[model samples]
Target: METDNKESIIDYQYKALKDGKSIRLLYLHTSSSYHQLPIEVSLCEFPIDACPSFGALSYAWSIDDDPAPSDRELLCDGASIKITKNCEAALKRLRRPKQDQILWVDAVCINQADLEERSLQVRLMRQIYTQASWVALWVGDASTAVDEESGLPLSDLGMDFIHDFAVEIAERTNSGQALNEGPLYQEFIKDRRAFQYSESEVFAPRVRGVWDVFHRNWWKRLWVIQEVALATDPTLLCGLKAETFHNLKIVIKALIRSEQPVDVMEFNSLFIAHTFHQFHVRHMIETGTMGKISPPGIKALDILNATRNTQASDPRDKIYGILGFFGPPATDTENIFPDPDYTKPAAELYADVSRAIILNTKNLDVLSSCYGFFKSTVPDLPSWVASWNDTPVQYFDGKIFNAAGSSTVVYEDCGDKLLMRIKGRHVDSVKLAGQIPDSIGYSNEACIELWRYWWKFASTLDSYPTGETVTDVFKDTLCWGSHLDYSRQQLGENKESFNAWLEILTGTDDTDIAAKRIFNDGEPFKYAHRATSVTWGRNMSITNKGYLAMVPIITKADDKIVIFQGSKLPFIVRTEDGTSKLGGPCYVRGMMDGEFATEEDAGAMDELEWFTLK
Candidate 1:
């Protein structure tokens, strides 16, 4: 009359004459049907193999769950859970005949709020599930259950501990198997006997299809592994891995689960986790350390970490190699950029151009590669605001974010097999355009040098959290990725000092409202700024002053001052502006000073006569 899969018992029934080989499922007729048990049968008469028992009967799921563990007690629902009369009836149908029974379940005993305790239990999983008397597999949706009831009936269990349809596993000794000594502990060996609660299709013992219920949180991934160590092959656990057969199950299963699994912060650091590569080679770099991952992100990091160490000696060595660019271990300077808190909602861009050439391992490249590296390393800012622009904004970590005025980066998108035009960052426009060609003849040393310089800049993304200054970016221990000839690369005697920025924007004084509006497509672009100068008319004309013509004028408000031809801008130089003034500084003051010259009327005055007005 009944089959083993009581959860689906109502879907298809046995004919008493012919039987199916699979676990026959019992389903309820109406979705409104609450929990109920099969007709009474004594413990002595409990058939062992493939027969339905009170525990296997389909019933309504009770709202009340298992007790919270000590660790999660704080997260417990105060122990008062609502249960419908339907579930009480189901419980009466399964209770032991006037006897006591111990139940083991994480939801009821452990505290969900205690993160530390929960984390430990999650790490120690093998000892949890296998030690129980019997594990109750609750397949939530009745429509998703499978059915099979062919083999001779002889199955077991003593308690009517099914509070509604959910199984109340009886507690027992801790007898789960242990794992081999390793750096990190994994879950139970799927083949072990202790967890042979379900009949596996291809392998030996199997757990139920759905082993653990979901509790959304990054810390819970560990708990999920701990709680349900076994699962029947017929059902799927995570949405991503349920349909696949590959045993590279850890990442896939965790990815399959609908939640964040690991501490994203670890990814922000450039690591050497080359599981698929040689352990000693430089290989991986994870970007950003906050929030969750989607299907795309999970797969990308998996591939990156998997291939990190193919060369060997410790992939970390490669990271050290990358650090070579910041220059000799030196003193710290104030960083000009802002430190972006990765924990907030923003995007992260990571690129690994640590590719090897015939002899050089440096990442020197053309604009295409430069843009790729720049975009990849930039934290996930809005794409619309990314790309090349006329004027640049300061990156949080302060590399120049502007692109050149009239150039774009070009690339071939293999998907369309067509060429595309994209813009470059300001530095890219200045450093990568037409310089580093696609060839490696090594002749374009200028561009090559710039490429290496940019790589040095990119590596600093790894150090952004510390608010380290840009001058010290390449100097940090984590900044270098390859070797360099520092002697030749030593930026000459002078460098962009901290005070230069102070004068650049504020001028000599603080009241100048003088600023230029940078436009893109004739519209104000987000976060754009103009380069202000700080020149003085005398020897002080170094892009920092207002020209008074009589003596020298130091700017008070804006740094760059304009020598206007009476109310209009006459001459303005951009910061570090190399453009020479087309004409000499002149005073148009004689008439403006109201001192009219009515004396010189001689036609074709000679050079001496011209000097008279001067």
Candidate 2:
């Protein structure tokens, strides 16, 4: 009788595999023991075209470095297999007390030890998560104790505050009321009053609590991007508490619209929140939630850019993990996106993916993400292929933020090897590079030192005529060829526009007082700090032809600033021997927004040369 029962269970499980409609679902049986539990794994076979209702588990693998062996026994077909402690915990928490619970967990469902099986299942990951009833995002056990950094408790109370804040803001947003006049603001004001007894004492802890949750390692996982984005309904599970992705998104949107002043900690939390919201928006567009009229699909390059910092166990998954979101409708004959292959090496895979995106998109924007010697930490890869494993350079999102105008160019794939040929203007070379000034300090002396460097550099620029004094040249350098003034020009004449520009650059309309304090007396120029503090990508460099230009902060003295035809901003290139290295995107003051592609500039392109990036 015992042998018959075992064989019967095996036959039932094997039937699903035979039909090629098999998926292993963990059936957690209720246990009276609080800590020890048994999980029954049953192979369920649905029709090949149809899937049954099951919640997919999206979670980080472990909390520590040591890979703990599967300690708990999971019964499958009357046989037992070991399961990890984390998995056991998840199953126990997710399981119902009286009824059996079925879940599709990657660790157990897929044969991870087999490479071919891993690759095949990864290809099916999109379908697995999408077809599931819902996705449970396990963010680990919740902590009510205060976080050391944010000084806020990681408990249900904090989640409640965030949810309430989101609810109030959503109501107002739906009603189309301005964010300032909305109930969100009113609630904020009330909180501020209640906490006024200790300005730093009260809000700091709460802000920190939000910060702690936002910075959770779960957000950094590459696979979670698709798991959450593709889910029909996703729930964030932190310990015993739960929150919907929809509510979190609402709170994120409200926080983005808020103009309230916050300390660095609050700002960091808000930045992460904004990034998450942006990811969701992009995910929606890619998944066709934005409708058919939206762009046919998202490029692999864009997906990579958005999720560059997302962590993965295998470095190759950095590219493979997000590949499912690319390409056309499932029914389309030709799939432009490269299929995930775990066998490929990280560098080679990244290079091939880069080539594929450029070939399919027919745009050189991918090249803009390639970093130069100074910018790139990866030395082995060729200069042309972007370091997919590296964190994306700050402020260069591959957008044409500062291009004078647009142009088209041809891309030559140069066979299967990682080499490409492009034709564009070489422009000018870098002669002198200065260290990016230190953070604008609170003391007056720091401002004076910064102003002195600016004065020396501005004096070299052709934009500042010879007759003008150092002071005059400094002002001209700030105002001349500024895109910020273009909108102000519609309101008034040149003099009015100049004053507006002066006010912006100096942070005050009283330019004379600001200038005198800096140039004449060498005192602390209150507005001088704005130059360094206001924006990123403002490292000062002198061109070989004696032009002072603002290049990417990673700019070196020998780096070449080249303006590729289709690119919006000038690029910093580092040349070693005969080959060239792209140092990523850059912002050169006057060359932004197609200014470089103006009629006169276009005509000057007759001297275009062949530039080979290795």
Candidate 3:
């Protein structure tokens, strides 16, 4: 007979494994009882190849820092150990009523108390998931309440809507009505009867059900990307309902492509889902399983940028969690990255990875990722090193600019490991920085006031440099010369869109009427979105040289703008105590495409000054 008493039980201890090839598996005993029953599991060691069939479990340890206390007990190997509320919920749902279930759960299978064992187990994570029979992705328990009309559990209703949405999308795409061919979400919103959605609003019960499903914490964790991508087959579980990962991927990709009713948080979920889907697709393309052309290979920089919003209990996992996407190194010694070492400090690990990415890519695009310096939380981090643990700041694509022209990066030999010395040309100083409004896109009146202020600021200049009207330059600067899709374009299209949008904004004194006109129009809010996206965390400013540009919010009145060798975008550096500290990357309108290198300054690219960044 088994009993569940905390005082009478001893905590389970983890046994050491033989080698890197060895792993532990949990065999959960079955019982015909509710989820409240005590969890009984036994762990056994086996070589990865020789282990019994098992399903890999992917889940978040806790959604937030203040997780519920670990009061639930798990009876393991005739002893007992406490587990998180989330882990207990997942195991209770996973256990079958008959026979036994074998699972490879990270929390239970790996010895968390032993740092060495953790590092070794993390190294085997890729192989463990890939070799498993299937991967069980547990989002969390569903709401216990049933829908009033449908009598279905809230999670079940949501999953039903999601499954049906995927089927409809697949059918439409196959029938030549590809949802991605154009603005499908907008069209869908217009014709609700076509998709069988009610004519009332976008957030009907079923539609909101879909939203709630994507909003789960499982979608936001950094580790699930590798787990789902590596699994041969993965099933998503919420309470008692289940869905194939394939179906869920379909809806997620569709949602991201359409950018429909989903807001920022939901969009992040879509991003995570899209990222792992791309990872799996890339693998299939490489194995020749999918006979189709593949997109550009994913790089370390791309992974870092994509997962910036994701969270990790340990900051070191921010770098270590995604290493599985890079496949095994040819040999242990030749590996581009050292094995995940839990012993190193988070800042040191971040610095090592930052250096490796620069050496591997041979570019400074990664430096742009060092944007959150003003609000960074990482201690002892170099000014140039990116703190991936912070909230993601504005990201400017370096590929769109050639600010430094054709010069390649010239690395200087710096004695200190924390300092990076580079050659750059000091372009200009910020003469005046405009106010960064908190309500640019969200408030119509606020947008109009801010726009009026910026227009007045631009009028202070006598004339423009590029031979264009002040109107065109001001509008282009507002949108960063990019369209709604973030594709860089010439002056005509964005200028027209901004003009039409401004006409409505200024046409009426009543903001409600103006806002309605803007929103009620076809593909409304496009111009405002394009502008706010560029200006959200940035400041519009005029340089001492009369160049109109957008710099990071951290840019001050006297901050110096410099174009570094081999860097596509210009850098803003603040001087203190005779040494320079990086403010962040910026966008100078005329200087983006080698316009800084004029015909008058012969060999200007060769005459770069050295600045040591601390």
- RMSD (Cα, Å) for all candidates, in order, is 27.9, 7.5, 4.8
Candidate topping TM-score: 3
Query: How many angstroms is residue 297 displaced in model 1 relative to the true structure, after the best TM-score fit?
Result: 20
lDDT of 1 by residue, 386-480 (tens): 21211121111111111111111122222321111121111100111112223333222222233233334333343332254433432211111
Q: Quantify how close model 2 is to the true structure by its C-alpha RMSD in Å.
A: 7.5
Global lDDT of each candidate: 0.22, 0.58, 0.71
Give me candidate 2's TM-score against the actual structure: 0.74
Better of 1 and 3 by lDDT: 3
lDDT ranking from best candidate downward: 3, 2, 1
Worst 10 residues of 2 by lDDT: 484-493
Off by over 4 Å in 1: 1-102, 113-120, 144-614
lDDT, candidate 3, 1-614, per-residue tens: 33455467788977799998899999989977755457889999999889888888998777444555768778897787778889888998888888789999988898888999989888888789889998999988885656779877667877887677778788887887856443434332433333332322345555555555666777767788778777887898888789997887776666655444434323334334524433454355347553322221226666667677777778888888877665666633223566789989887777777766666555577787576347667768877788888765563466776777776665776787677787788889999988775544646556556665677788788877777777777777887666654567677775556777777755645766666566443344667666756666767789998888777876889999988776778888887886788888887678888876422244754667788887
| Model 3: pairs clashing at backbone N, Cα or C within 3 Å | none
Off by over 4 Å in 3: 1-6, 63-68, 172-202, 256-298, 330-335, 436-444, 504-524, 597-606
TM-score per candidate: 0.19, 0.74, 0.87
Candidate 1 structure, TM-score to reference = 0.19
How far residue 56's Cα lies from its native spot in candidate 1, in Å, is 15
- The deviation in Å at residue 289 for candidate 3 is 13
